[model samples]
Target: MEKPFSDYWKEYLNIQNAPCGQVGDTNEDTLNLLKNSDVVCSVRFEYRNCRTRIPVLMKMEDGYKAIYPHLSAYPKESEAQLMKINIQIAQSAGVHITSNEIIYLNKEYIRKDYLDLNEFLLRSDHLFNRRNKPSKTIDECMEQYDFDLDEWIDTVQTLLDSPEFTLDRSKKCTTGRRCSYYDDCFDESKLPDDSILFLTTSSHKLQAYANGIRRISDLEPEDIEGFKLQYAQYMASKHGIFYDKVALKIWTSMIQYPISYLDFEWDTFAIPPYENMKAFDVLCFQYSLHIEDVNHNLSHHDFFDTADCREKFILSLLETIPKKGSILVYNMEGAEKLRLKQLGEQFPKYKEQLDQICDRMIDLSKPFECGLFYDNRMRGHYSLKKVLPVFTDEYSYHQLSIQNGLNAVFTYRTFDSALPEQKQVIRQELSNYCKMDTFAEYVIFHGLEKYLKEDDVNA
Candidate 1:
């Protein structure tokens, strides 16, 4: 920023202009650029140590307008604070700030919201770290800033004045996931393998950790809100597994003949690509179905398409799934069943047929999700990927080119630009991945059936 109109900066931002007279170190390049251009993308500025990044700066007749693009469904409070703080930064930098708008590119739709800094809900006016607070890291201290100059100065002085150093394990909990320095910073290896700190519930884990409850064994029934998955996890930590044979039997009994294990892989577009699709609607482009008859003959059925797949996807599914049997889907509420419902809504003509299929659909995950079946090997998680290994190690996502749904979606996204050979390979990998998913459901289903039959024989 010291060298205004620097070609490197312009090139980095991908907005290069030819021969703009820019005075060095005088903030003249920004003025020159604004004078010539209607809009500037990603105008960067630093004020009061906190970073101010404006995505779009439009030269308006009145003054200037800042447009911040928010990609998520809901903007976080901290994000809003950072956005509003830009107005203060622009004022400091002598850019006449008139209005700020947030252009939401959310999953629902594109929306523009005018931000009134007068309300200033994100206003901050201080420096001293709260007694309970972990002192700001080096990066935080150096980059701290405020709308109020006095408060910004206080932030600097407070950092210089020295603050209490509190070690926050929770910070390590998440930062460790991605940060390489985490291993050196915290020795979580000291904690038990089944540490209560690893509980999925954040509030509960933090509370228990604060109370010095270290291991999973230390947690009692009273600690959890109610019985179910958490209780299964707690008990399994001691016993290594939990199998309510009776409950599992009941779940297994619900299955009719010629059971079909269903799985869907779909791409979610922020903007609706198809006519009937709403924003964030998933286009069901691929499916894998495994049907097992009474005689134990297994057949595989699948469909995949890159373009205009909505109608074909529905028709293929209806044709593939047998008319007279149970349709078993893992995570019915979220995945396969939901896809069916959406397809039905999108194609009203096929709603009756889709509903018929939906009626036959049964969630195969009921036993594991409800804690009727659990294995410590699952590590307190019940996703098909997590649950698959307990039943058999013969199959694994690691062995496949496309390991998960997201990978399949990402690969399909590149299909349009792919070379002919690449296209064929991509198509095959996509099919294999989806096939594996339905097969995984079958593996689990078969395991359950075998478990029930063996239990009955022993009884």
Candidate 2:
């Protein structure tokens, strides 16, 4: 007969309390016991009057103290209202809940030998405890994030009762995440070619719309409020695409051969996988380098590892990249440069070489970033992927399996557990995606050069 979950947990806790006989044996035993235990892992809260249901409620208890888990690291913008609704439901059920707690995975513990539930639990401290502030309890959080319960109920009832509703286009939408229905709400395709939306630096979008300023051409110098770059972008869009030949020429002149166009793909794990690695430390798994020689010859070098390959990646880079020349990386300030700096700190033995690499590195995004280049087709985006399509149809990322950095990270992460055939496929997809980034840089460089020369000839 199988043991009841409560009994199993109680027995397991007893074993944990007992003196450790062996180092590895206790943890392994605990893990095996946990796997065998069967319990109600999920809870569904159904309201009688309300149509909505709370799908998952994580309940944590130690002795007589019980609390609901606050899962997120930071309180979300909508958390106050959501908490009020939850508290209202609890109150109606004759359950008095005073405060909420948080339970998160311990980032310090690596599952090297076996899973340690106690270690995990200890690490998953409540928000206040984690922040080292015992005085800031859940009650304080409730007070700080208080919402009007009656007003919330009224709003919910209004929403439920509404049969037909018009979209609130004028409502100031703000979020860190992209809205799915953005295209459905505001059709960018239907917008005029010279729409005020093209003004990338304009914070007065709503004001412009209100004042009947729709097109970039319609914008007066006075309307822009002394923003030279915004004015330049506006004038450029109105005439055609903007091209600063002298600025671009000077920018391109800095490119010394053998030019190494580099791109890296890395993943940030919540838990540290290796020694000296902190929680959410990035593991660089892959890199792609496209080298162009002084003789106009092109060669490619790349590295991909299924495991923690930080050391191997750096070594490969040092070997593959020539001792001399400029290293061009798109958005160097944001991605590549930061990654290199982190790597240098992680591997101090290679600090000198890494510092040299950083010294030679140049941002390929400068021209577009400085507003020296602009195309109407770019749609206010300066991303390499967006800029690439405007120049030539020769290169594209649409055909690749791993088209974006996020997809590459996800794919690489799954490689260790994947089947042999699947692993091979992931490897190829990652290589292709990273290679495209550097290759795109190469293409854009030449495209800009050709444009400059052609403009000079026409002049």
Best candidate according to lDDT: 1
Error of 2 at 203 (Å): 1.4
Cα lDDT tens digits for candidate 2, 337-408: 888887887789998898899889999888887778887777777898988997889779998887888888
Per-residue alpha-carbon lDDT of candidate 1 for residues 316-386, written as tens digits (9 for 90 to 100): 98888899889889889887778889888888999999989989999888888888887777765688898
* Model 2 backbone overlap count: 0
Q: Candidate 1, 182: how far from true, in Å?
A: 8.8
Residue 168, candidate 2: Cα error in Å is 2.6
> Would you estimate the TM-scores of all the predictions?
0.76, 0.78
Which regions of candidate 2 fall more than 4 Å away from where they truly are?
Answer: 1-44, 48-81, 103-138, 160-163, 170-175, 225-229
In angstroms, the error of model 1 at 363 is 1.2
Provide the overall lDDT of each model, using Cα atoms, as 2-decimal numbers.
Answer: 0.70, 0.67
